[model samples]
Target: MDRIILHCDLNAFYASVECLYRPDVAHLPVAVGGDEQMRHGIVLAKNEKAKAFGIATGEPLWKAREKCPGLVILPPHSRRYLHFSQLARNIYQRYTNRIEPFGIDEAWLDITEKGMDMAAGRHVADDIRGAVQRELGVTVSVGVSFNKVFAKLGSDFKKPNGTTVIARPDVSRLVWPLPGERLLFVGRSAKNVLHKVGLFTIRDIAHASPRVLKGCLGKAGENLWRYANGLDDSPVAMVDETDPIKGLGNSITTARNLTRQEEIRFVFAHLAQSVSKRLRKQGLVGSTLQIYVRFSDLSHLEHQGQLPAPTQLEDDLTREAWRLFQGVRVQKPIRALGIRLTQLQSVEEAAQLSLLWNEKKRQQTAQLEQCLDQIHRRFGPESVRKAPGLDENLVSLVRSTGVASLPGRPHAF
Candidate 1:
């Protein structure tokens, strides 16, 4: 039996969410962005209206404005985006646990265990697409297929709100005519090599001999060939599954350039707490702490230090992160900051506290943060805030955007 998979993608995710909340930008060309004066002014995401004006994400806001004079740019809201991402995930859970997130706005669902066929997969996709629109006031495009790669391509086949299906028999008719570069994992260098190999379309690559592709592009070529011919068999990971990863991290591009140590501390407190929350949620702890600093001019440096012990406490992570920050004698005023923890171990096998640090204090901090976690889980994430996070602008900036990638957890909306 063939596997049934669907790739669901939220349409204009960041901008769409903003529109639902901010009535002021209704029917206007909108884009989410950072402070232009702070050198973080690129368009992070744009709505369909803005896209029609040739406004591209990651391009400077000034350039985008030139394309559309009436472009209404708004500051990014990180916490809100995370909230909506969670809401969408909640809806997806009703169908299957075999949901694998690609990013904030895209995920792949495997419903083979439900005994779904290609037709039923499309039905499921349409159901999800409708649920997201009616329930969340946001639209989604779904691509139904037998594998991840083709499903992803199918999602991109249409926009805003769409559903496209590419079954095994339809591969040549629906997918083969596209450019070879459009295939998953095919980047610039790979495209050039494929062109040199006289493979310009998915059909060209699909029909090419494995030896020819391997001789040209190595393992990547082989992978591309497999994807083109519908040979991709990667599983859609369970939503709640935690694979043993190298590390976990969170970072933020501040709303404004941080000039003083107090400003830096404010952001660090929020980040450490956020990272610790995720670590504890996954029942893991880290033995090494790393600090990342991006300066006003975008030049940056990173440094890592050993923790007193593997810890999932906010205070401990904050202490080590601050220590690492102090050790780096940077002359430039910072534009953004990040914290990461590595050399992790499951809480069950975590080692004893290092003698250099007070064991009683460590235990106390751990206990305190754990209580806060329960409070957060019960009330809401923002129910509690550190006193140091009182700086109004800094607090707003921290809440605006969080570049976080952590273990997935199961939860209800």
Candidate 2:
């Protein structure tokens, strides 16, 4: 039997979720993100009605509003969206354990082991979409194929509440003529490189020599070349609690160039807390903390410091991040700031605290974070955030700039 992968994506997730509560606005052009006064606000997600008007994700809200003056803008409800995502995942788990959540709105499920053919898989996808619509009042799109890359592409072939199946025999016909950008991992740089070699489409890249592509893109290039040919072999590993973290980082692009010392410190504290929450979520700790600042002129500054002990403590990380920020000379207004934790080690494998005082502090910090996590989990992320970081303008800016990568779908053989 050929491997079968299914990519399921919520249709205009945030917008759809909002429509569940405000059904009257279902037919209107809607966008989800920050308020317009927050000049840095960008479209996070848009409903089908809005997409029809040329509104795209990451497009500046100001421009989007101008294009569709009647656009109904809604504030982001991350907690609400996450709740729907969990519900979607619960439903997916019923079909297969080989499920990989790409993000809050997308996931991949491998159903090859069920011995179902493409038609059966399409039925399953349609059923899942129906379940979400009936139960959660949201629409979803499912793409059925033999690999993650193709499955993802298939899902996008249809829009809100649509499904497309790409059989193994028909894969090339469907994928070849598509633009290079439509292929996974083909960013601007990769696209340019591919173009330079006269390989501007998936078909061109797939037919190019793997050795030549590898020489150009290194390992990543090689992977893309393979992906274009519909040859992905990656499995949808169950999300393991013990997996080592790939990276820990937080960034905020200020609404405007910031010059105040207090404001900078406040941003650092917020970023530290955000990073710590992610660390705890993954059961990981880090030994190195790095801080970055992008000045108004686009010049950047970065500082790194080794922690005396690996930690996932919000206080420790925040204090260190603030100190690093203070150490830098602000010759110009700061456009952006970021904090990252690297040199990761699993919390379970990390050594215990040495000194009695140090041990006591570590225990206390851990307990505090656990409590905070519980509260945030039950209430909302904003429920327990640092008081100083509650500057609405700044918070909106940070939320607007955050990257949202769609979850990876399961790969079929």
Candidate 3:
């Protein structure tokens, strides 16, 4: 029997939650934004009304204001979002213990064990949507399907509040005509590449030669082909199964566009420092390091490369991230810079060593980082400097964006 899966996504989550608490702005077009004074003032989330004004999430607040002059911008309230997220999770627990959270506002539920057939799954999706609406005062869009990938695609089929069911018979009719990007794991960058080859829709992706797709998209192209053909059979995680940390990253939006190499390095150093510390704390190391750059124009690009070896040392991370950034041809001043460590392995695993590099130097550096972590733990995070203190403006900028991770960036599962 085909397993039943449902992807539940909260509608305009942050903005909806804000409206619930701030009734004064409930009827107006509202958006949840960051601190303008801090220069992180981007539309983090917006309600349906704001959507009508062409106010998009991740666009600048000034631009959003230009689009909708009467737009009400409210600061984010994370605590409330979390409280409501947990409450919604509680509702899911009543249905099944096999719940896997895609993000705070999205989750996947495996209801096959409940003996639910495809028809029953749609009923449950409606029940979940209605229950969340009545109890939490927020709407949910749900996609019910046989597997995780299609379930996520189905949930995204409708918005604000709707339930979409995609069963085997519906694949050719409903799923194929959608854009290739809608098939999942296809970002803007990847979409352009596929488009270049005339693979515009999910049907095109499915019908295209696998070799041709892989030649264009590499491993991701192959995955897209499988997803387009309804070949995704990945299981939803059980509730008791803790999600493993797949990657670690940190980023900062500067108060000013960073043009100087020295200033950019300072930002990279701080971000890498935070990420490496977190990796060490979690007892993990990564072999791949990725750097993300958002230019002053809001245009962005990301590049990544394999490291010399798996590492959790700040110096190693900073050096590798800087190496990757240097290869990018700078067309514009940087508005934001980020570092990410992926292809991670637990520190408990034996690290590969090479005589090609000085292993002893790396050991010394790791020891030094551990000592610094001890000092930072006892005194404070500011007790030690990572990269021989650069500009004070950059120093405070990093401090202001303390514990910076990619805000609202979801992992493509």
- Model 2 lDDT tens row, 305-380: 8787788888888888887777888889887788888888777767554412387778887888889889988998
Quote the lDDT for 410 in model 1. 23
Candidate 1 lDDT over 1-413, as tens digits, reads 98988899999999999999997885999999877765568898999999999998877788999999999988888788889998999999999999998778889999886566888988888999999999999899999999999999999988989999999899989999999988977876779888887899999999999989999988877988899999999999998899676687887777777888878887888888888889988988888887888887656777899986678888888888888888888788787788888888887777444332566877787788899999989998778766766557767766645554433332100
Runs of candidate 2 exceeding 4 Å displacement: 239-248, 259-266, 273-284, 288-336, 346-348, 352-413
Can you list the residue pairs that collide in candidate 1? 78-400
> Which scores greater on TM-score, model 2 or model 3?
3
Point out where model 1 deviates above 4 Å.
113-115, 215-217, 244-246, 250-413
- lDDT tens string, model 3, 236-317? 8888987666788988888778898888888888888888888878888888888999998888888999987788888888
Which candidate should be chosen as best, given lDDT against the real structure? 3
Number of clashes in every candidate structure? 1, 6, 0
Better of 1 and 2 by lDDT: 1
Q: List the pairs of residues colliding in candidate 3.
A: none
